[model samples]
Target: MQAIGLIETRGLTPALEALDAMCKAANVRMAGFKRVGSGLITVIVEGDVAAVTAAVDAGIAAYPKTGGQLVSSNVIPRPHADLARMLL
Candidate 1:
């Protein structure tokens, strides 16, 4: 429960698809999301280290199916506690 996974995409559809894939691929929960302006969106999930890794991978892999390009994917293995407060 110390990891935070993020998948950033160019559109809302891709972001939503990635979010769904992430939750289905691992023991993770949707922490929140951010609309970074100019059509960019980032989806965040929280879980254990391994779970977050798997979730992020699944999210990235689903980008093609979503028909939207992936901007980036990241897993913060030991995110600061203060960051958690800002997520949701």
Candidate 2:
């Protein structure tokens, strides 16, 4: 993968919202997601660096509209092969 974007939220609803927005905003593909307990959930997307960055930004913008708290967000460009292997 050229890049990976992640968006974490306090609830499933917001996470889903973010994922939808991300997909709509860029040419990114859903990688996977994880629920880490305590209602924390994360959505992952993969694409080219610019696309991933745009998707992450779109996700962050859409998340708060769900009235849920955002935990964190990140975009990793040209990630190490090992990290990409593990994440993708």
Candidate 3:
């Protein structure tokens, strides 16, 4: 992947909402997700840099609609090979 996007939310519902918005707003693919306990969920997406950026933005924008707090969001362009491997 040229880039990876992550959206972390306080609840699964908000994370799902973010994932839905991300996928619909860009040509990105779901990598996977993890629940880190305490109701925190993180959604991951993979795509080209531009796509990832757009997807993350869309996810962030849609997050509040679900009434779930967003923990954080990030887009890493040209991530290290090892990092990508570990994430995938």
TM-score of each: 0.93, 0.95, 0.96
Best by TM-score: 3
**Residue range 49-82, candidate 1, lDDT tens digits:** 9999999999888779877889998899888878
For candidate 3, what is the TM-score? 0.96
Give stretches of model 1 more than 4 Å off. none
Which candidate leads in lDDT? 3
Could you tell me which 10 consecutive residues in candidate 1 have the lowest summed lDDT? 79-88
Ordered from best to worst lDDT, the candidate numbers read 3, 2, 1
- The residue pairs found clashing in candidate 1 are none
Q: Write the per-residue lDDT of candidate 3 for residues 1-88, one digit (tens) a residue.
A: 7999999899888999999999999999999899889999999999999999999999999887898899999999999999988877
Between 2 and 3, whose TM-score is larger?
Answer: 3
Clashing pairs in 2: none
Give the alpha-carbon lDDT of every model: 0.90, 0.93, 0.94
Give Cα distance to truth, residue 79, candidate 1, Å: 0.9
Angstrom error of the Cα, residue 29, model 3: value is 0.2
